[model samples]
Each structure stands twice: as structure tokens, then as C-alpha cells.
Target: MPQPNDHRLFAVILGTNEIASAIALQLVRAGYCVVLSHDPDPPVIRRKMAFHDALFTDTAQLEDIVAERVDDGVQVYQALRRPPQVMVTWLGLLDLLPVRHIDLLIDARLQKRRVTPDLRRLARLTIGLGPGFSSDFNCDVAVETRPGKIGFVTDARWTDAADGVASSLGDVGAERFVYSQFAGRWHTPIEIGTRVYRDLVLGHLSGVPLLAPRDGILRGIVRDGSEVPAGVKLLEVDPRGRDAQWTGTDQRGRAIANAATAAVRLHAARRSTHRNPA
Candidate 1:
């Protein structure tokens, strides 16, 4: 059972992909009380995280996991009643399951065909469940949204127009839905992984000083340690060298250099976990 001050973070990492597992592991390392609930919990998955209340066998097993927590004297009534604070669904999950929350929905599976009826249905489902709830909420077949951020991870593989589609989600009544496009030439997934993990860590520890991933040439020192605020520019990433420049900022455009480095450190922690498994 966690204290009132301890964050009661619930997450569901669906699928068996390395990327999905990596994201889940990163969330666990970031101090989130995550539950990797999947229909099929593989041996590799169990071995990777050892055994944790954080990992559940499947969605149906969620009640069992919660009950176990209760037996252990953990307070999980609100968690059982409310949707998870965080959910990292794989691209495959989007095709079948209607994701539950919109406050921070992310689509990492943009490799599939776009503009299809299926895609539109998925989009509509996401929009409806996201921060802006649709009147069609009576349907039990799909999940619903709460509040916060919804995003799609993009790289060169994605068309420029995709950004417009993702960005337009904000208009559907979400407080904000962003297309987190990366401008890097190599290791796109690795970088996106780092960025998302960093932001997740920050969001979990403190509610202030949000980190918004952006595109540009980055130049800055990699600092180690916490205590960085949302407004300090820890690094510089000028798009056109010094001649033309662009700076990374929070969703609010606050310079986050110091905080940015703190974000980087979070990724490092993820790496450390991979290197030294429990």
C-alpha cells in the first residue's frame, strides 16, 4: 500500500513487441506503479520484469491483481473504479481495442495504412474517448477518455499531413493532442523511446514543468541529477546552426534546458535497468 503522498499510477502495456515491453519497463523504472496487463503474458515478459504487482496476466486478471493488492492491505478502490492514469498501448492494440483514456493517448503504430475506414474509426474512437467525450458513451464495447494529452509518434516515415491530423485532435475537445515528430536522421524509435520515457518520469514525479518533444538541431550539455525546473534551457538545438535557431520548450513554451537534462537522466535510468535486471 502506498502512502497518500506516493503516486498511484496505473498503466497497461499491451502486446509482446520489444518496443512495448521497453516502454513498460521504462515506466516501472520511473517509479510508476504500473500493471503490464496483456491477454498473453509470455515467459520472456515474466522473466524480464521478474515478478511484480506491476504486471498482470490480462485485463480480466486486473480485478484479481487489485484484489491481491487489497489482501496485502493496499488501497486500490479508486484505481479499480477509475481508468488508469497512464496507458501505453501498442499500434496493434489500436486496430482492435478502443483505448480508454485521451488525456495522454499516444499512437506509436502509424506504420499501417492511413485514411482507411478502419483508421478513421480508430481515430473517431480515440477522439470520442479522449478528453472530449462523445454522446455515444453508452456503448460498452469500447473504452472512454478522461483528460490530458493524446499524441502520435512520428518520424520521417510519416507524411507531413499526418501531423495536421494528429494536431487537429485538439479541436475535438481534448485539452491538447500533439504529433510528437522527431527530426533525427538515425535511431528514430530509440530517440522517441528516450523522449517519451523522460517525459513520463517527469510527469510521474511532479505535476509541474511539462516537457513537450519538438524537432530541431539539438546542442546542449547532458546534465545528471534532478532539481531542474520547467523554464530553464539546459541544451541548445538551433535548426540552422547559429544563423537560424529553434529552441525546445514545454507545451507552454517555457525554456526547459535544465529540466530537459533532467528528462535525459530519466532515460539513463531506463538504460541502467536494462543493464542490471532484478
Candidate 2:
């Protein structure tokens, strides 16, 4: 039988978005084994930095950490045995892993709705990021993800309500986004770091042009040949036109990572105190 403290903390992050990937990298840096769960067909717009892109490429590297797609629980365990390695898998394969091995479960999906996973009972500590999760009924802790309230980790009974609007960038606001007009395979004609003016054609989806909404650097965009649905975000332009946006983790992602680290430590200390009764 495995004891509670028999091994390093094994954290399963349920999503491969930027924040989730940031958290996984942070946990690995803290000497914890991390696994990322993602969908087989992830509709992620920021393919350059998202760990979910490993689903299509089979492997992805964030900073210095590398994540490889694994097929089953055995592979996940094997990947964890190698320190600094992270495993990526779809939800079904994630469910097949032994729940006893999970020390923490962080729901970083940011779906703005109730997650279907039985996360509270799946691990010793569970965390939900953004909205749509109640600490009293869903998880042990909920971290605020809204722009102004970013990184506010709490265990209160209530959860924050999603505003359903993207955080504005200075005076640029929502004009930095470009969406597809038709559901079909997407192809990009311009490179990611290219600076472009408003109305410049960035790509096309089933013959419909994906135009730039404003003048800025193309900070992020979906990969070419991706099957996209109509109205999906296809690209993002950084109005600041800074090259730093093309590389490394963003400020918001790092803040969320810090909050998750604090939550895990707090819960681990509490559990230890309960077990030893010092």
C-alpha cells in the first residue's frame, strides 16, 4: 500500500491552456510530478504556446520542460518516474489512472461552467481556476482568474461569475481579436511575429479571409490546416507590438501559477497536521 507521503506530490492539471501549462511547469520546478489532461481535438487558438498542441504534434516544449502524449495509465506512471517529465493525455485516459496516486487535481479548464469531473473526491486536494466552481460543493479551493482579481486563491463557499468578455489591452480593447467566419480548415498566410496593419488578410478558412482587426504584432494564432468552427478565435494581435509576447509565459499565467503553488502548500500542511496531530 502507498502511504500518503510515500512519494513526491503528483498533480494532475485538468486542461492544457496557458494558465494550466504554466501551473504544470511550476509544479515540476517545485519537484512535483505533473500530468496534463486535454481533449483529443483541442480547439485552441494559441497553438504556439499551448501544451495541448502536443495532441497534434505528439510532443511540446514549454520553456525547458517537455511534455509527451501518453496513451494509458502505465505510460503516465512511467513518464512521472522520470523527473522533470510531464504526461499529456485525453480525459478518458486520465480517468483510467489510479485516483489514489493523485495528490492534487487542478481544474484549469476555464470553461465558465460546472465541470463534470468528480474532482473533489479524486484527490487529497482539488483546485478550480476561474469561474463555475464552488469551493463548498466542487473543490477545496477556487482561484480568481478575472483580470483585476487575478491570483486570488480562496476556499470560500461561493465562486466568481464569468463576465464572458476578454480582458482589454490598453486602448486596443476587443479589436485585437480576429475570428473565423466559416467552419472549415484554417490556413495562415502570414507568420506569427509579423507586424501588420488593420484589415490585412492573415489567413483564410474555407475561402473566407481572416483579416487583422487592428495594427499590432501577430502574437498568437492557430496552426495552419486545423479544422476550425465558425466564430472561433483565429488569431490575436498584441497592440503593444512587443516581441516578448511571442515567447515565455505571460504575466497572468505566472500569477495563477503562484496562487496554485500557495494553495497546494496550504492544503498539504493542513493534511500533515491532521495526520500527525502535533
Candidate 3:
């Protein structure tokens, strides 16, 4: 059980992808207690940017902050004692933890669907990201995640246009992405963040060579020993090489992070005013 602090707000972030990691980083910097919710066996391609990778490694660090995987609510309480800390847990145990203690719930799963009924009412403020969500019905706020309209926050009913295509980085969109051709366990020989040329053999999927589509830096890749299905994204290359690796939090992710932080502060202020009407 976490110690009660009327002045402190507790934020629970669902998912630990790039956008979610950015939001968690911002919220922690803003002095909110953050709990990063994730799956036990997360299939995160961008391992460097996702804190959910902590599930396998026991701990994953982003910039200066570190996320530690916890087994139960007691550990979560202990972790929260340190401000700007992150407690990682799966959904099942997450629901078992005390919900009343959560001040905000951010559904950053980017699952392209609405959250379940129980999640909508879990915290004082609930926020959903991307498509498949109606702000008026699914959550208190919805953050736009499409290419051009990224970072747009709304409280009214709104749905983003479904393009069903990944955002392109010049001609690098689909080409940069590497997928498994056969359904089986994937084995990668090249490490993430490594520089490679076009047609470079990265690894083997069901004994077939997984090659790079273009000359670029290996920015993101699935775990080496993950059981991958056919057509699953295996990795991605950044054609811009080392320059792209230095560029932190792509435009869309940074934009969404900014909006989410603003919304959190706005809601916090409203709650403060309601409690001690001046």
C-alpha cells in the first residue's frame, strides 16, 4: 500500500512504447508518481525506446530514469516511495492493485481500439491514445497520433482517419521495416543500433536469411529469441545512419508527450480548485 500524499498525483501509464515512454519520462520529471503497466512477454520491436523491455531484463533505463519490474502491489508501493521511479507490472496484477490510489490513467497501448469498461472508470482522469477511441465515451481525453495531426488533444468525440499504413520517413517507411517471411522463432545476428548496408543478412527466421532492405542503422529490432509469426515486423533500419539514432523521440511521439503532460497539469489544476474552492 502506497503512503497517502494529498498533494501528489499518481499516474498509471499503460504500455511502454516510444510515445508512452516519452509521456512517462515527462510525467516523472513533472513530479507525478508513475506506474508503467505492461505485458509479461512484451513483443516490443523498438527495444531501446520501450521500458516494457524491462519485463525480460528486470530493469530498463531511458535517459536517466530507470523502470524496474515488480511482482506485486507491495513492491509497487516501495517503488513509489522514490519519486520519478517507475514500477512495471502486467495487466492482471495491475488490476488487482489499488485503483482508488491512481489519479490518472493513460491508455497509451496504441492498440487501435477502445479500452475495456473497467479501465474507463479506473482513475480520476482517463486518457486514450490514437484511433478506435471516442473521447466522449472511451476516455476523458484522446490524443491524436496520426502523421499530420499528431499531438492534437480533444475531449469531444473524435476519430482519426484510418490510413492503415505506417508513417514514411521519406522513402524509408515500408522499406526500412523488416518482416519475417516464415512463421517460426527468429534469430538475429546483428545487434540493434548497429550500422549495416543494403541486403546485409541480419539473421535467420526458420532458416531463411533476414536481410536489411537498405543501408542504414539498425534502430529497432525484436528480441533475438522471440517466437515470431509470418509477416511480423522483425526489425527496422534508419537510412540516415548515425544521425537518426541521435534524434530522440520522433516528431509524433514528442508531440503526443507534450500534449499529454499539458492535459495532466490542466486536470490536476481543476481538481485542486474543486477541492479548495477559493
Candidate 4:
């Protein structure tokens, strides 16, 4: 983990969604400390959202959130209110917020295309698709394009691995709002959140491992552990539905029940080996 005083970078997720929370977790697991702030909107469920070290419901809690991380082992105070070198924009707030020190900006929603000009004008590194694709055009870092979603990095900043998606695929059947928002809407918030945390923000491959914890067929590795960084892909299961197929195993052809546990042990042992050399 990085020391709190090391010019620590952060991913300030603008919206109170899975994208924000996932990105924060990914960054923290990868050794970068994170501060997640969200003001609970009325009619919105207020479940405690855990990102990295600190979590809060109000902006006033921001300093305290960051402060707790400092005590635990994060050095983000070095930049004050300015976002660090790396930033993730899950929901729109880029224009409203200060960017004088933000080195890279990432737009996860893929809905706001107009923000790019302002982002570029600011000279902050950005990456995203154009207006024709999604709203996330103003990102300093973009990611893979998944028809309705765009993912990539600009100026070396990483993107969240999970793509933004609509819930209840086929439920909305071609409404203008659905089409404009790129809704086939198959993914649940938890699914997207898991992916963002494991892949993009963590700099891991898109094929990170996933355990079915039940009988299922194997899908390809979304992220192989060795090929990419810590927070890249693990693996993805087929979508749930009547037509969805199970591979009987996980991405690695391993039994799903033990995969998660094995992965943890393997990772811990690997780190232990590094720490205590024979």
C-alpha cells in the first residue's frame, strides 16, 4: 500500500452508483488510497457504500474521510481539494468540480459527450468515445467499446473494466430513452460494480476470475492474473436467462466452488514468498 504522503492519486466518483464505488475499491486494492463521497438523494436507498478507507454522506465528511485514510496509510492530503493525477468520472460533475490539478479524467457513464471540449481545454489528459457513441466522451482515459459502452485510458490513465449497462434487458423494447442511453440494459448495478472494482480501476485485465459458487459452465477468463496489473479482468459469467449457457466451470476451467478461495490463498502465498525469501 502507498504511504498517505506520497502524492497519492484518487478517483472521485461523482455519482452515487456502482461505478463510483467499484472504482474506489479497485484503486484501493491496487495500493492507491481512495476517498468516496456521496450525498444521499431523496428516494434513493442509503445503504452504506464502502469504497476504500473512508466513506461519507456529505461533502463536509470529505476531510474526515480522507483523514481516516491518512491514519490508516494514505497520503492524499498532499493535493488538498484538487483531484490527484488520476480521476474517474462515473456521473457528470466534471464541469462543476475543480480540475486545476487533475492530470487525468475518466468518464464512466459514456453518456455525456459535450464535456470533452472543456476537458481538452483544461489540458487534463482524457480518453473516451465521441458523441455518436456514449456520454463519456470527456474522459482523460477511455476503455474498450462494448457497443453501447466505451472503455479506454487517455494519457495512460486506466478505465473501469465494467461497462455501463441498463437493467432488465429487453424490458424497455426500443423506447427513445433506452436507445439514446444505449439500453439493452442487461447488467445489474452489483454486476457492473463488481467489474469496475476488479478490473478497470485496479488496472487488472477484464478477465478476472469469478466463482459461480453453484453449478455452471466455464466462460473465458475476463482477466488472467499474470498478464495484467493487480485490478484487471478476472472472468465473466454468462448473463442469466433462459438462453444463457454455463460452461460447467469458471473461466480457468477450475471448479467454481474453490476458485475464489484458491485465488486468495495463491495470492497471499505469492506475496508471502516475496516478503520472506528463502
Clashing pairs counted in every model: 12, 0, 0, 52
Candidate 3: tens digits of C-alpha lDDT, residues 21-115: 88988888888778777742324677787676787789988888888887777676655555557767765525734743677888787765334
What's model 4's TM-score?
0.34
Clash count in backbone of candidate 3: 0
TM-score of each: 0.24, 0.87, 0.86, 0.34
lDDT (Cα, tens digit) per residue for candidate 2, span 153-247: 75665567867678876556667888766678988877777888899989888877868888888878877887876666788888885533755
Tell me the tens digit of each residue's lDDT in model 1 across 120-230: 242221211112122243111111111122222112122222222322222321112121122211111122112222232222113223342333332221122223332
Candidate 2 or 4, higher TM-score? 2
Candidate lDDT (C-alpha), each: 0.26, 0.76, 0.74, 0.30
Candidate 1 Cα deviation (angstroms), residue 145: 26
Which residue runs does candidate 1 get wrong by more than 4 Å? 4-6, 35-104, 108-111, 114-278
Q: What stretches of model 2 exceed 4 Å from their correct place?
A: 1-8, 40-42, 91-96, 113-118, 181-183
lDDT of 2 at 131: 80
Model 4 Cα lDDT, one tens digit per residue, 137-179: 4433344433332222123333333333422322421110111
Best by TM-score: 2
In Å, residue 248's CA in model 2 sits off its true spot by 0.7
* Candidate 1 local lDDT, residue 67: 13
